[model samples]
Target: MIRPRHILRVFLLTTLLTTCLTGLSACGFVGFPGVYKIDIEQGNLVTQEMIEQLQPGMSRRQVRFIMGSPLVEDTFQPDRWDYPYVIRNGPDIIREAQVRIFFEGDSLVDVTGDYLPSWANPNAEPQGSTESEETEEAKES
Candidate 1:
């Protein structure tokens, strides 16, 4: 004894529910549009300026003041301090960098990893060459 109007309402509701379920499932497969993804940053952020300020023979206290506390300080390698940084946007990594500072006793000896001080750059123009060039120019004058 169902009326025609009741049957139509039920059919419409069922169709609407099915469509909603299908759309929600599709959203699971291909993330919902317009969703905001946050950029996540972690660990010490060492910049080029920080690296440039480093100099060999600096005291451990001076190095720490310039570079900040390290992210990893291994007990086995007490002389080495590791600074690692990462930036991620959702599931993708945007950037990753690391710097390892080594010390001999309480004196900073070496620095390595993604960034290096100007003194440590192998491809940098030699300081001696620039001085020699300046002297040659003066002699020519």
Candidate 2:
């Protein structure tokens, strides 16, 4: 048969466990809080409104008027303009893009890309215009 000392030991163990659980529950011991932000330094996300301002038939000069100078331009691929921006949520975490704009002659032709995630294809060729033309197409079709 169990002695009274055994009953006391069990009671002490249960009380210790309950006290520890209660203390942990009261403190910030679970589920870390998250922070949200906007207007990143490198990733100033150009809004859709800005893109909507651009039209299929807009000239390269017009696109410049809308989006400002690009962040990068290739020496060999002058038709390709890259707008790179980044947003840092915290250390080691970032959201960014180099929104590529491609031109054929002087007409703004296509969006090369905007890579936002780490897993996306960073080197996907700008979407349109395989050949850089000498003159802008007089009118878009």
> 12-114, model 2: which lDDT tens digit per residue?
9999999998988875544346744444476335665676576565788898888887777799999888787776654444666667777888886677455
Query: Which residue pairs clash in candidate 2?
Result: 42-85, 42-86, 43-85, 43-86, 43-87, 112-126
What does candidate 1 score on TM? 0.70
- Per-residue lDDT tens digits of candidate 1, residues 56-119? 9999899999999999999999999999999998889999999999999999888899999878
User: Which prediction has the highest TM-score against the true structure?
Assistant: 1
The residue ranges of model 2 lying beyond 4 angstroms of the native Cα positions read: 1-40, 43-45, 115-141
Provide the overall lDDT of each model, using Cα atoms, as 2-decimal numbers: 0.93, 0.67
Model 2 / residue 112 / CA error / Å: 3.3
Look at candidate 2 and tell me the lDDT of residue 39: 45
* Candidate 2 weakest ten by summed lDDT: 112-121
RMSD of each candidate relative to the true structure: 5.9, 13.7
